[model samples]
Structures are given as structure tokens and as C-alpha cells.
Target: MKLFLVTKVVPFIMQLFVRFIYISSKKVFHHPKIDSKEPFIVAFWHGELLMQPFNYKRIRPKGKVSAMISEHKDGEAITRTVEYLGIDSIRGSSTRGGAKALIGAIKELKAGYDIAITPDGPKGPRHSVADGIVAISQKTNARILIFNCRPTKYWQFNSWDKFIVPKPFGKLEFFIQEPLDISSLEQKEAKELIQDKMLLNAMK
Candidate 1:
């Protein structure tokens, strides 16, 4: 009964919270390509996860979006939370079933589904990028669109990733970096640059 409530009821509450975020947000979208029908990867950090599903809906309401979630209990709850916003989640993470996550993302990308990944997520050293995301981008040949969202007014949780929740009627400065072609950069270089950029923006 407790587990059921956590999975079902908690996600319901979270969906409501996300709804509040959407309606209250003062949004600025930087990339015109995102407004198009072409599918791309949105590499976002774990801390700013609350806004991603809504971001997808706001940008291209009908475009398919998918992302990897963990196989853990907390992940199960979050998977449900995101599903409420109409995004599908696959169970896997870098520490567990990482390969499965990559395979799933690749399949979705090939099918032309826009995918998002929190490189420092599901547990984090905060703003760090795991190589799996880089691999997925390389395999899919999808340009990576980096997300840099900074809450102008918000609450920061005492979580490992210092999770953020924007205050009601507050603005969030969301800057989408120019799309990066993974084929042009070495794997390590690409991951490092992404991690650096995300960390820099989060600290801003």
C-alpha cells in the first residue's frame, strides 16, 4: 500500500507541481531548430529535471520524447512522474544497466523520437557527464542541444544535486546552447565541454 501510494499518489502530486511550473514560467526559447519537427538530443543536468517534460511540450507538443531512468525504486517513482506529462521512460542508468539504456536510446533515436538525458542524474557528483550520453549521441548521429536553466527565483533543496524548484510567478533563464556535432569533436572532449558548460551555467 505504501509503495503504491509512492508510485501513484506522489507522481500525481508531482504532475500538479509540474503543471504549476508550466503555467507560471516566463519562457525564452533560444533555438529555432527545437521549434522544428526534427528530432535532437537535449542534454540537461539532473538538478533542473522538473522543467524538462514541460519544456518539450511547450516547444513541440506532438514530438515524441523519451529518456533513460534508473531501475531503482526512486527512479520508478520519477518514471511515473514524467509519464504523467506524456514522455516515456526506459529503466537503466550508468551504474546499472547502462548498456541497456544506450540501446534503448539508440532505438528511440532511430525511430525519430527526441530524447533527453541527465548526464549527472539518477545520483550525481553534480554537473558531471557520463560517457554513455556521448556514446548515444555518436551512435545516433544526433546533434546535442545543451540546456542551461537558471532559476531567477527559486528554492534549492538539500539534495545531492541541489535540486531546484522555481518560486511561483518567478522567471527562469533558460538558455539552449548551440547544437554540437559529436562527429566533429573527440569523445572525451565533447563530454568534458558539455559538463563544463552545464556546470558553468548552473553556477550562474
Candidate 2:
């Protein structure tokens, strides 16, 4: 019942509200690289989800983009929300069906879809990066770009990552770091580097 409500019913209402609110008041400041066409992996902390999708849709290349979502009740809502934004979603998490999720992500990347992941998502230790993102990048030979969203006005959920919801008509700042190429690095080294980059980019 909970999943049904979140996946089917709640999204219709939330989508309407979020679209109206986001469209009414949202300003984005971006520093995107000129060569953004190449397929790459996008990494962002989970807390900044609200505004990240909007910004990504603005700058992401004209290709299929997929986001990794947890197979939990909350993920149902997120799946719907992402779909409304016209981005595809793959349901799996580090805790459940992780291997399959990673394989699917790699296949998507290979198929030319830029992938998006939340290193500290599905339940997080708040800003911590998991190894899955790094593994996917290494396996797929995809470059990783770390992105973040800073809101001038928003509500902070008392969750592990302090999830933020930008208020309508508010200003949002998007920070895009240089892409980290993982094709050459060892798995352990790549994970460390990506984790550090994700943390640095997410900090205020």
C-alpha cells in the first residue's frame, strides 16, 4: 500500500507542486565545461537531490541519463519524480541487488547514457561516498563529474544527509568539478579519489 501510494498517487500531486514551485522561482549559476558532450558519470550527494535534477536536465548532454535508486519505499517516490523529469531510473541499492544495479549502470553507460549516482544515498552516513560509484566508473571506463546544488533558501529534512528542499523562486548555485577519469586508476585508488571529490564538492 505504501509503495503504491508513493509510486502512483503521491507523485502526481508532488510533481504538480514541485514543478509549479521550481518553475516559479529558480535561478541557476553554472560553470559547466565547454566539452560536456562526452558521456560521463555524474556524482552528487543525496541531500541535494531536490535541485540537482533540474540543473542536470539543463546541462546534461542530449542522451539518455539514468539515476540509481534504492528499492525502498522512499525510492518509489523518487522514481516517479525522476520519471516526470524525463530521466530514466534503475532501482537497486548498495544494500539490495547492488551487483545487478552496478552491472545495469555499466551497460547503460556503455550504451551511451550518462549515469547519475548518489554516493551517500538510499540511507547514508551523511556525505560519505560508497565504492559503487567508483566501481561503475572503472568498469565502464567512464569519466566522473561531481556536481552539487547550493540553495539560498530551503528546508532541511532531519534525515541522515539533511535533505534540502529549495523554496519557490529561490536562487540555486550549481558547482561542477572537473571530470575524474577512472579508466586508469586501480579500484581502491579510484574509490578514494572519487569519495574525496564528492565530499569536497558537497561542502558549503
Candidate 3:
């Protein structure tokens, strides 16, 4: 029963819920000038993951999008959910299957797909940026696009990242910063810049 719910039932329900909330709400965007054809290493905090598929659609409707998801059970539900929403899921994370995931993400970006990564995810030191994403950006020579959102009304979970889901029928603001090219910087310097940008746009 639990397996069935995680693999099938949860994703189905969550998809319906996400669609209703997003369709009913007013969306506002603060986007930079974007080139629809270039791939990006799209970074956002883990807590803000819920609305990103739709957000990505608005920003780059024709661009392909993929996300790195952990191989855990909770991630199973999320994987199915995002796939349902038209984004591909690369199964791995920092603690498990890290190498394979990194390679997969690099390939995706080189193939012209925008790969979304949660700088802090699959468990946390909550909002801290991880080096894996920066390394991927460097290896693929793709710029990191920082994205985040805030909803006028919501529920905040007591998880490590204080995960939030916007209440139905509210306003949602999607924020996007200009892409950061870290290929020329030292790894430490690049990681710090990504962290600073993520922290600056973090939802309240």
C-alpha cells in the first residue's frame, strides 16, 4: 500500500493540487533577458521546488528542463510528480549516486536542456549551496540561473528546509536573477557567489 501510494497515488493527487493552485493564482515574474535556446544550470532553494516546473514553463516554455532528484522514497513521489508536469528527473543526489547524477546533469546541459538543481537538498543544512552544482556549471560551461518564488499565502512545513506550498487562490511571484558564469572563478569563489545569490533571493 505504501509503495503504491508513493509511486502512483501521491503524484497523481499532488499534480492535481499543483495545477489548481497555479492556474487559480496570479503569477508575477521578475525575469532577466533570456535566450530561449541556451541551456542553463537553473538553481533554486529546495523549499521552493514545488512551483518551479510551471515557473520554468513561463520562463522558457520551449526549453527542455530536467531536475536532479534523490533516489529515496519521498523522491520517488517527487520524481513522478515533476515528470507528470513535463520535466525529466535524473535520479541521484550529493549523498548517494552523486557521480552518476553529476555526469547526467552535465550531459543534459550540453545537450541543451536546462537542468534545475536545489543548491541545498535531499536533506539539509537548509539553504546552503553545495559544491556539486557549481562543479556541474564549471564542467559544462553553463551559467547558473538563480530562481525563486514567494506566495502571498501558504503552509510552512517543519522540515529542515521549512518546505512551503502556496494556498489555493493566492498571488505567486517568480524571481529570476541574471545568470552567473562561474567558469573562470576558483571553485570556492564560485560556490560562495552561488550561495550569496541564492540567499539573497530566498523566499520569506
Among all candidates shown, the one with the greatest lDDT: 3
The residue-by-residue lDDT of candidate 2 on 115-192, one tens digit each, is: 889988888888777889878877777888788887778888887889888777786778878778878887778778
Clash pairs (backbone) in predicted model 1: none
> Relative to the unseen true structure, what is the C-alpha lDDT of residue 181 in candidate 2, on a scale of 0 to 100?
86
lDDT of each: 0.80, 0.79, 0.89
What stretches of model 3 exceed 4 Å from their correct place?
A: none
What's the distance in Å from true for residue 114, model 2?
Answer: 1.0
Which pairs of residues clash in candidate 3, taking residues 3 or more apart in a chain or in different chains? none
Best by the TM-score measure:
3
Q: Which ten residues in a row have the lowest lDDT in candidate 2?
A: 28-37
Candidate 2 error regions (>4 Å): 1-4, 34-37
CA displacement after TM-score superposition, residue 87 of candidate 1 (Å)? 1.4
User: For each candidate, what TM-score against the reference?
Assistant: 0.92, 0.90, 0.97
Provide the lDDT at 102 for model 3: 95
How do these models rank on lDDT, best leading? Answer: 3, 1, 2
TM-score of 2: 0.90
| lDDT value for model 1 | 0.80
